[model samples]
Target: MKNMNQLITIAFFVLSTNFFAQDKQDQQNEIVAVWITADETKIEIYKEGNVYLGNPINSKGERNTKIEVLNLEYTNGKWVGKIYSKKRGKLLDVECLVEGDNLLLEVTTRFISTELEWNRAKS
Candidate 1:
């Protein structure tokens, strides 16, 4: 009886850990998809190695010639990275969150900050 109980306890611990790990993976993967910007631009977010990168897509669903606009990594329950600002001609600090069907990006500078929302693109 003692041996059987110990086996059951070990099995429960392993199963619970696996479930929690899978949940965390699902949350991290939620941001990996095509998202549409407020101004109607499409940005595709993909994982390259350990980091996530995003680039704009043209009208015909092709990647734009410009450099990647987003470079982010998941850390401590949030996505932290840099976003390239075409108007400002520099990379700015950014933090991202995925909420339901929307991905929210918060861009910050020394004296200013702004939030932008991007919706997940339909398949």
Candidate 2:
């Protein structure tokens, strides 16, 4: 009976350790970017920490919006979030994922897609 209890404890600890390690790994691989599309212009996003701040830097070189970060979702290997644009006064959702050495981004509501090479910024 004592032996069985010890085995259960050990198994629990091992599983907990692995789960946490995987969570840390997933956080480390998150991505942030300034996405550009033909119609809407730009979107600024941060995947990890579930943070997002979207604003159009320049719409045809003219200011057109006030933007703020909204609640974003962060999955182990996926990012999906929505941003509120002051110019349009609306929210737009986007999805992103890592594929090998490239980053995949798609704004389904807008039907726009882009693939950008991953460049690690000096931390």
Candidate 3:
């Protein structure tokens, strides 16, 4: 009887650990949805084929803006995104974040500063 109790305890512990691990992975793999203020276009960004692709999520439009992501850096418990736009045929530098149901996108060029808020979508 004691051996059976020990085995059950071990099984519970292992299952709990796996559940937590999967939850963490789900959080990390979440996609950040964005809406560009320049043209009111909705874009969904996902890491696909080992690269980042931004597509019009709900509405379709002629969009030619995409920055290849090299790495994702986190700071102060916030998700920070960095991308290279020179290779994507754009002259914009972006550093943005996703917090709860809000996204703050910062774009800068030689002499332009654009900051916009992106409300998250309910899924």
User: Could you tell me the lDDT of residue 105 within candidate 3?
Assistant: 64
- Per-residue lDDT tens digits of candidate 2, residues 8-97? 999999999999999876664455545554354554445435454444446464323454533366665576776454456787675666
Candidate-wise lDDT, in order = 0.92, 0.55, 0.56
Question: What does candidate 3's lDDT look like per residue over 1-123, in tens digits?
Answer: 999999999999999999998886566555444444335545566555444455554435444444333234433434455534534465465556666676676766667866766666555
Give the worst 10-residue stretch by lDDT in candidate 2: 114-123
What is the Cα-based lDDT of residue 2 in candidate 2?
100
TM-score of each: 0.92, 0.44, 0.53
Clashing pairs in 3: none
In model 1, the worst 10-residue window by lDDT is 58-67
Measured by TM-score, how close is model 2 to the native structure? 0.44
lDDT per residue for candidate 1 within 1-123, as digits (tens), equals: 999999999999999999999999888878999999998989999888889999999879987747799999999888999999988999999999999889999999987999999999999
Q: Show model 3 residue runs off by greater than 4 Å.
A: 32-39, 49-77, 84-96, 105-116, 121-123
What overall lDDT, based on C-alpha atoms, would model 2 receive against the true structure?
Answer: 0.55
Please state the error at residue 109 of candidate 3 in Å: 9.4
